[model samples]
Target: MPAYEFPDRLNGNAVNAGDPQHRKNLADVLALLHVGGPQNRAELTRRSGLNRSTIARLVGEMVNLDLVRESEPRETGVVGRPSPVVQANDGIVAVCVNPDVDAIAIGLVGLGGKIISRVRHKTRRVPSVDKMISIVSKVVQSSLAKLDDECRIVAMGIAVPGIVRVDQGVVEFAPHLGWRDEPVAQLMEERLGYATFVANDANLGTIAERLYGTAAGKTDVIYLNGSRSGIGGGVIVNDRPLSGVHGFGAELGHTSVARAGLACYCGRRGCLETEVSLSRLLDIMGEASIDPDDLGPFVVASKDRRLRKEVDRQLDVLSVAISNFISIFNPEIVVLAGFLGELLEVNPERLLERVTSNSFHQLSADVELVRAGLRSQHLLIGAAELAFSPLLNDPISFAQLKA
Candidate 1:
């Protein structure tokens, strides 16, 4: 038996993989590559505390199953031989889908968080559930047709900008998308014959950041995203998501900022999202919209006084929310994505200053505030994590096991 120590479980209690034949043993090895990217066999032995023979057998089994591949080691001027590098197989794919208020993105994501291809279909207006499903099915068909012969898509994941019932994969309410009680995962799985999972888009973003983005190694984190529709958020506590029992946790946009300012879609008044908005920012910029990749710089370099004033006010409202989150969670890092990230880029110093003023003195001192490093593809990669969850857990079933 090997000592199975995951990065998140390195607090001195590494489990012992009970038996060599048990799938837990296989999963432990796979999870290492799946999360940590790649490593040599000797490094794997050091990490797993397994004998050379056990690590070799596990790597061989993974290679035969098409779950991983090995490459010759590069010379580093060391005196001894270097172990071969073993990496997760990128041929195994996950179909990722995200339905925003203005567009829908469908992507083919391979293992190791590689985005093979993505198609973003723009919409003139908010799409109905049936229309959204039709678009997803068509794009998925077109995307899959171009897959390489060695590549296989195992499952589909949907990231929704709305209240989601994760277990049911249903959109309980997406005020911007105008959806209610739609079983998106069930509907898609029935249409495509692949297992499907769904979650709140912001929640997925949090997981993606923790695994592959800015908050890679941090456990406690607070993430806020501003989109065309509105603001959304996610929180991580002690390495696990703080998603509520009903899956409505971290709806920071609805956090009341004013007692009698404006009515919201959730039947609330003066919500944080009501004050700080992406569409408003775009409208102030005197255009319907610009590419998200361009919005931050555009906002930062603009010469309009009105735009600057409105942005300052929006940032003030946002600071209140950020400070409150910091006081409660005291996370090591706070990531701002989407237009919220743009807001930071526009006037990072001003926003952080305001946040610090509102926050507890000690709590505000050490917390790091930064933009999401993944940029426009954060949500898509997050959705892929959802689709890839099952394959990572049960590699034996998906294995071809050919000679």
Candidate 2:
């Protein structure tokens, strides 16, 4: 069995791990820091139920390993001496990638969800797998060269806009990108010399929301991400992401909303994506050539009657889909991300009113419909989280292996 297989037993109770007590302690400390964010030594001791002496020793060891840092002491307002704040070391960074049809976004994300640096590479045309790999590898090499020696690139994570077999790190299909059965993670690992994980873009977005955004501490959520080409979705149930049997379950955009609507690139008619995608909205408003980043301003400033009618039509369709999702998943939160977020920010009342009226009262009453909290960097942060998961879950074994 792998050393990382040990179950989490850190709930204010001591476990008899026999030979692995030290490892358990290390894992528990890291897990607490990751989940609870930065905390003082006293707070860590209280939350982990570990004795102060033990926490101090483990924290010191982690600090020595360049995994945790202690801030300058601050006075506690009482008669006691000041205590130092403890936080995860920012020097440990992960490479995060978000690949889209027009460009690829790459970031160096440090621990504690900090995006230290980022770069965007625009392509004149949709690049092939080999071409994308070459371009991204060069970008990654350049980024690495500019980083300080203390900033270690521990791992890499990629978010692709399509169905992915995450366990195998293979992109099963990305219709928009015309990619199929691509071993993205393996190829990236070979090129970058770091273990890589790949996941669907929307799924990563959902993880970001749950970890550090609007859906933090939420058990059930439905997330929708709108892009120029299409929309993507993810579902979280009981605090766990519901990636279907093949890790392609929450393709909510393809759900049929109209009986005989526009044709979709997925070879379906009336798919929700065809009706409500950003590209479709732009096309209807006669701005098909506008840059995607400028879409929010374009919509806000346009007085086109066609755009108004199209927005109204799509809002109704979106309401129907969201109402259906509410009935099906009974989620605690529904997050609209990307262009969908802009849509909500522009006219939240229209969508909210439609959804509330359409959905069952009892179900919709408790569901909070809101815009995405993470905004622009959610996907990048989500990828970093993927790379950080192994260490957060099994810090001791990971440390041992690395050493």
Candidate 3:
């Protein structure tokens, strides 16, 4: 409901701002405000293990850098004293782009995980790599032109539905979009002149959930979503994305679920995407696409025996994959999005039952299956996280604020 909330634990081993440690101190305080919502200096002092004087100085520096702002504390009946609250400045923005099979979504996201503005460009056909880039450029330029001079655009992040060499910002493969070894971020950075980053859409989704969605404050999480193109997902372990050494790991969509099912575009049989498809559900619904809000109601209100049976059947197959992930990852929560979310919405108990029975470690760990909290905006918000990474990691350098 809120744009962002407090994490279970603040990350970063930031000590007191002693000489070189000032950067870490600034990073730590900023991280608290950015990830854990607004808080007073007292709370920051407790969490960061910094003295009041150090925290006051750090917060003051960030305020000067325009990274955050302080507001008079709200009056609650039980409060002894209301200290000023430090919150991220929404004026600092990042350009987020996500190009899927049917549409290219561009959003301007501010600090504190706020979605300032969003627009989608629908396409009749799957646009090529070059075509998508062109569209993104147009949308970004037009959007930036409308912003006032105070609106600081620091970076741009693009989420691709493929294996990305995140360190290099190159897309190794995107079967849905028919791409390979595309230097998408580099091109955009050269054209737009802002720092750019590229990442796997599902990986971004996983991070977004941890940042502000259902998995917020969670350490280990599993996120899977079924869209028209296919299923894509990501995993989080110990609060870090399990992106593997090459950033090609955690390709959850292609995880083989069947010994021999339908062949997948990735040269595999019975891939999760091939087996559990959104198009199958949409075809049965007799619509090209269903509204995010209407999907559950339509499934619930409809008494069609065929639809009910199909939903159950897909759930049966999907449960096997979910259980497998639970056993392996031992995640606290498993997030299902898009059509898969519709499955959970229709019969949460039934799906949970199936997943529990199939999971090897079900008896050992309490795993909760939930829907994506950010819903349709998860991907865009996820892209925003990547764009915000640089600043979150090093507030001093990102803002060019020296000690």
Candidate 4:
């Protein structure tokens, strides 16, 4: 519930590429603060594996940078000292942008990993990337203006629904957005005047769950976003998303289930996206003479039945694909996020049953199929986390910031 409770430790303001000893001491202090919450000088020294003198010196610097703060004293019975607490500061704010189908969401996230402000702009009929970036920049600028200029706008994380070159800051392709080799980060930085990070929207969603949501601490996990555009996936191994050699690690939508099936945007036939995407599902229903999205107010208004059936079919296909993933990756958790995340909440047991039935017995035995705790905000939160994470490292400075 409190901020700074994400998967990995914070970066940028916490740890920098400084003297090894200084960084180690800072890391110790951070480890203590993260695990035990607020602690005084003496408590920090004891838990951080650092001496009292080292803690005193390091904490003084942190205080000056507004990265850490002192708290009131707490008394222990029969104790001669009432130790004052030193806590990690949660004032620093970062911006997160998620460019999705319906709209672009911008969120102001604090160092403690809590969202402080959020705004959404409709994509409208013409969802140009330029328009989306402009809107996002305005929202971020407005949010930052409210805080101190020294508020450490550490990083800006963006989630795009396309193939991204993480190190290159290039979007190789985005069929839905009609984008190719677009320098999204450069465009955003040009508009906002801060470093920007771009990642696959679905991958970011997976990171969102792995860092702050239900999949925390899991060694291997799969995050799936089953939306109308497509079903995207982000695969995590040892707490890191597998970006692959070319940054296209998990393209779940393009994976083919039926060898000779529906034509996909990728020039492939019978890809999973063609069958499981909401748009495709609607088409399927249309062919079946079942206007589930149109008829049945409960089916349309609530639309549980229609969605459930479609999700079931998708899950069946997912089961086969996931079964292969499990056999290969052997992940501990396979998280279903995105629009289907809401649906899973309504029929968890049923969905889990199908997934379990389709997965390998040995692999499915322990694998958990769960819905994401974070909803539409998953990608947004992931972006903030991506930027702020590097800042939270101890003895933090600009050098330790990631690209």
Compared with the true structure, all predictions reach lDDT values of 0.81, 0.80, 0.80, 0.69
Q: How well does each candidate superpose onto the true structure, as a TM-score?
A: 0.91, 0.90, 0.89, 0.81
- The regions of model 1 sitting more than 4 angstroms off are 1-21, 400-403
Worst 10 residues of 3 by lDDT: 2-11
Best-fitting candidate, measured by TM-score? 1
Lowest-sum lDDT 10-residue window in model 4: 288-297
The C-alpha stretches of model 2 lying farther than 4 A from their native spots are 1-24, 265-267, 284-294
Point out where model 4 deviates above 4 Å: 1-18, 27-53, 73-85, 144-152, 280-308, 393-395, 399-403
Ranking by TM-score: 1, 2, 3, 4
Per-residue lDDT tens digits for candidate 4, residues 1-403, read 1122233223323433658777757655654554345778977776666778888888887777667788778776645867677876656667888775656778887665677787767665445678877888677667767876556676688888888876656788877777889998888778877778777788778877876688877869988886544778888887667777766888877888878778888898888777656664455445322211222232335545666577667657666676777777889998877655654565566667776777778877988877787766677787775665455444356433422
What does candidate 1's lDDT look like per residue over 165-204, in tens digits? Answer: 7767779988899998998878887778877888889988
Looking at model 2, residue 35 earns an lDDT score of 53
- Candidate 1 Cα lDDT to native: 0.81
Best by lDDT: 1
Of 1 and 4, the candidate ranking higher by TM-score: 1
User: Which should have the higher lDDT, number 1 or number 4?
Assistant: 1
lDDT of 3 by residue, 1-403 (tens): 1222212111132333346678868877887787788888888999889999999899998898889999998665655877788899888899998887877888999888889888878877887877887888898789889887878888888888888877778899888888889998888877778778888888788778887889988888899977766888888787777766665778788889996899999888999888788777777878766545467789899888888888888888999999888878888999998678888999988888888878775442588799999887888888887887767766766676322
